[model samples]
Target: MKNFALFLVVCFLWSCNKDDQVETYTYTLGIPETMTKVEWRSQVAVQAPKPIASVGKIYAYQNYIFINEKHKGVHVIDNSDPTAPQVVSYINIPGNEDISIKNDFLYADNAIDLVVFDISNINLIHEVERLEDVFNYYSDYQMPAEVQAADYSNFDADSQVIVGWRVEERTEIVNYNESFFSDNSLATNTVGTGGSLARFQIVNDFLYTVGSFELKTFDISNLSQPNLVNTNTAGWNIETMFHADGFLYLGGSNGMFINSIANPAAPEYVSMFTHWDGCDPVVVDGDYAYLTLRGGNACGQELSTLEVIDISDKSNPTLVAQHALDSPYGLGFKGNDLFVCDGASGLKIYDKTNPLDLQLLHVFSDVQATDVIPLEDRLLMISDAALYQYNYDDQNNIVLLSTFNLN
Candidate 1:
């Protein structure tokens, strides 16, 4: 009987250690990839539209819209008929991401350089200039924290450019501190969707863009030749940018930064509205500035929230309202309505007439929305699966206008 009891105890200990034990789990891991300078700077041109890698920034001009496929190129979509939009063409710009339109010319970043395109004739769009090595803050190959990375400590940076990543998978026992989810992310945005998540914004004759931690300004007065004028240390983890009234608003992982572009070429740092760390994008309407804090497996933030700040005074932005959110991403305004794209929770329309107590008007929960650009009564939304257009003429009865497949 004593021998039998000892045998049972040994079996339990072995089972706990070998089968039922040590906390761990499986997660998709990513490794940084590098490309030869020669390959990265391959000849770029305009081609017919093909399936884009992913949606990045968005820009609207007249009846056209530009969508970004990070490190790949930009697509020109003809939304002349929103109900039946057409893919016009594709700008084959290697290592491209953000874009902004001004006076028929489109400004885009191509890795460490700024490329300008003459789109006056959409049918024959052509590249006019390639300003090299200007974007010192260019971070095109940033991978997610959720994906455990392999070491590449001795990687060469002189002749190799980090173009993308190599993703793979492996399993381990479930660890309480480890994490994994659908797609290994709520959504990475690839380039982060919508105009609200736009890295570039054109205000006046100056083009402003925010990198990971700096503000880069370009003088686009020459249209065809945009020269890099100023590169100012913006803030830590700066992600998105917006131009409202006469100021440039930069949204980062930790807070909102306001800069005076009074001297377009040289933006002067004004103030910052601090908040909990998260991936965010700031959008402004009239006297108030709106942003959403999206915490996710990739973002590393603790909570999802919506914050509204009074920006009447650019130097001292005051937070007057704070609301809880369900994994919010991008936000935009349509007159009195505020559209919040809350990941899987859906696209929520709020009546901001009462900012202190925002009234939830409606929710389009069928789609996994990422960001939005409210154009007139029509809303342009980018999600994980597609680029969606909606008609919100009837605020209470918002209807899907059309969709362009992204995946």
Candidate 2:
């Protein structure tokens, strides 16, 4: 009887403890009275600059690539293969904007001087000579009736008569006087002036450099020293010059100018293709010319568009297609495709397979793309304070592959 009473007492104490632990606690479900959540956020992915990286834009050679940075020198990339590019060396050049290569020589602009580099070696690039004697090549002014005579235009008779509102057409309606300047003293004169070298080209035995107010020609049969041959006043704000087919093309704030270089010592104005405002960044292949219009500084008008023209007939270039874009600065061609360095939209690709019907193929964003050149089969190099490689995939698509930041 005593053992049974002890067991009952232990069971009663355990049940009481379990009941005390099972008691519920009170709580409230409502908004917090002390604070509120802030719902704002930011979005901007930035990458820090790396050492030994390319600085500005990039130019391509058969075996290597050249990249330009603002204050740093040019970076050379080994491109034995398209997909995998590695840096080889850095060629020190300050204030460089762009580069062009021909016959183992490299040409670059230092804003104040037109520089020529000895690039015979893919491993080392050295500055050989600089010409600061360019004068009267370019300006930011309107083309006079005498100068505009060589440009093609579609202006109505009334438009030409309108004083301030007329779109000064660029193309000349009449054929140039072929016999007028053959015996002129100006054809064989040597004139030197202090001008900016905006664009240059070497065709045949002649070297052409576009200056602030005139197009200057030199005899380059002697490669080491270029002798001034002749100069012709072309246009204002001259942006770029190119030789295609049998003609030489000039880009200006005014429009596109075409001249026959069949006689290099005496190039005659053939025609002009007019854009709404200023046309810049010209690239050409065969019968087609690609250009960008970055609008005007004056308030009355501005143009933001890409223009493709057909120059089969040198004296009457025709506009085939146009596409609107942001501040465009550079143009490049690979096969039948066109690449534009649109200021804000990055690098844009288009199919010029049908020059008359240009189609947008792809775009790589955030590049601030200023210039583009093909590297090989499916890769390209872009410039924007550094050199970048972009690749096209099996699906015929484009993607940013690598970046080399030059700081």
Candidate 3:
């Protein structure tokens, strides 16, 4: 019989390579570590508002749903028909927050500039260049104990003529010495200093910006003259940076940095995975790295966390689990699920295919989500300024296939 059809074609090619092998499910939470109450409370069946106030992410494309308002800017929802989501347009842009689009252009960012829109007129989209002062020459740091000189904890014995008039006061205070503090001093308004604008990403044609400790690299292939090319020093505050395969996974407040751009205008650090510090947000696949640490304090001490790391041995990184959510700001991943915007633990969902057993599953709560995008079937597409579409029912409940109001 032709040797039994070659043993059934080698058992159907070994059962189709064990069903396309990528199976690594490890989610646990059979509740009952003495079960610390959580009877369940997450419901927001629907909501759609976008005249803007403080939204953060949502992009569904192919019928629209672009929102990004976190201080206003971008909102265009129509979604053709993902079950009716309509708000048409509200592309304002006044102090935008975050946005991305790639192909047809749309790379917003406010609180200190970087814009580029032209949705190819998805319905009259506009603007196409903004890029302000690119940090207008950042220079304001202080913190060497804020130029100390006194506080030897009430020293006395004539404290050497009051420590020689506070060590001849002024190791340096700039900004015209801020009227000598004490108007409720924390350096009393200390203008022009420290750092901000600490995050941006879009590797591959480059855009990588970040501040509060430098790390730029523009050259958007010429998004109307981007060109900056390379300059590193991001010792931290690099908010986010994922890329993949060729690695570039940063996350900030000085922790995870992994660069190895394979030579995209020279980049090659490849190592570093500290954790728990501040404002971190990262997501990666094909070797794992899904971080989140929402700033620091603790929870009441401020900042909350949720980590899941296992960089597939990327220079030995490991700590496959840690969750204590509260302010876990934005971190999206689709496919083994892991979405967290937690500005109060609102849009959290985690399964993470066992990166050491991470499994939360669902949460929708009070609408302060921030960002989360995943649109193919079970649909999920969130953002705060207006554009939400959860839908995950069959009993797991979480309905609301659409709601688009991008004001």
* Number of the predicted model whose TM-score against the real structure is largest: 1
lDDT of 2 by residue, 1-407 (tens): 11110000000111212433332222111111111111100111112223444345556678787666543346677867545667676655433445666777776554334566776876555666666524322111122222211111222221111112122322112213334224221122121111123566778777777754468786766554556788887765566787887677888766788888878798889999877655476888878888987754431136678888888888898988888887776778777678888876788888888888888887867677777766455555455455667665432666666665544
lDDT of 3 by residue, 204-270 (tens): 6887766655666777887655667677776555656667887777776547888777887666776
Model 3 TM-score relative to the real fold: 0.28
True-vs-predicted CA distance for residue 247, candidate 2, Å: 1.3
For candidate 1, write residues 1-407 as lDDT tens digits.
10110000000111124443454445565555777766776757888778866767666788998888866788899999998878899888877778888989988888777888888999999888888777755433555444443324433555666666677775545433435322222223233311222388888788887777778888888889887888899887788888887788899877899998777789999999998778888898888988999876446576888888998888789999888888898899988899999999998888999676788888888898888888986999987668899998988778898988866
TM-score of each: 0.80, 0.62, 0.28
Name the lDDT value of residue 3 in candidate 2.
10
Give Cα distance to truth, residue 350, candidate 3, Å.
2.7
Ranking by TM-score: 1, 2, 3
**Ten contiguous residues minimizing lDDT sum, candidate 2:** 2-11
Error of 1 at 31 (Å): 7.5
